[model samples]
Target: MAAYQDTFTSIPLSELATLAQSKKDEGARFINIHAATVADGFVLTYTFTSNETVTDNCQVHVTADDVVPAISPLFLAAFVFENEVHDLFGINIEGIAVDFKGDFYQISIETPMAVPTKPEHATAVNTKYGATVPVKQRKGEEQ
Candidate 1:
């Protein structure tokens, strides 16, 4: 078996479409695009695979106001991931082959994965039972 090799490269947002086109010309399959919220903005990762063992990723960092170009023109299936990232992370992706216009998901919360700028929404606490449970009922506090 060939050793699996994965590589990540950071690129400017403007070059995303070019990178995708280059990868397609190289006979690589578009794997997927992933988005994550960062302290100041968001990071988008575009992944591609070749030879079933080699994976290449292109990462871009953009602020909420940055407009990202869609790669769906090169990879038709990229529309799904682009719409998802736009709907969930609120990234402005333009020129999607199949634009969903934010209707891709029937979610009530807009940009739920976006970074919270308000102080109230910045803190999160998770309890085993629930936040409503009295402190005395916790496992360590149980008598």
Candidate 2:
């Protein structure tokens, strides 16, 4: 048993991507990257694991501005992880699928979107984006 453990570190997404590229250039594969946001900042995890065991690992937690925009068009899973981060932590990611709020949630009491009805994003984040059905004005001489 060891009394010390490896620590997590946070770096910008752009930097992380560059590092990944460099690693690939050096013939490393089987990489995984995950990002998380916390009360004080965010977390970025990078790993090159094989045989279901982590041999090379790195984790970084950083302040809001310290993150890198996940270049998700390269990796499909990055897109999903980013969505979960934005939905739960409000961390903004550029070029995200929709870059809005409110997913397929039930709008229940436990949901964060209804907290104050943010007149701006409430409409776009829903899975039903731009899905307004026609409604008619009724009961007037002008109608």
Index of the highest-lDDT prediction: 1
Q: Which model scores highest in TM-score?
A: 1
Off by over 4 Å in 1: 115-143
Candidate 1 lDDT over 69-96, as tens digits, reads: 9999889999999999999888899999
- Evaluate all candidate structures by whole-model CA lDDT and list the values in order: 0.78, 0.49
Candidate 2 local lDDT, residue 125: 29
For 1-143, candidate 2 gives per-residue lDDT tens digits of 33433334445555766765665556554356555434445566766533333346666665444435654544544566666555554455666544444372433433243122333333432322333333344566353
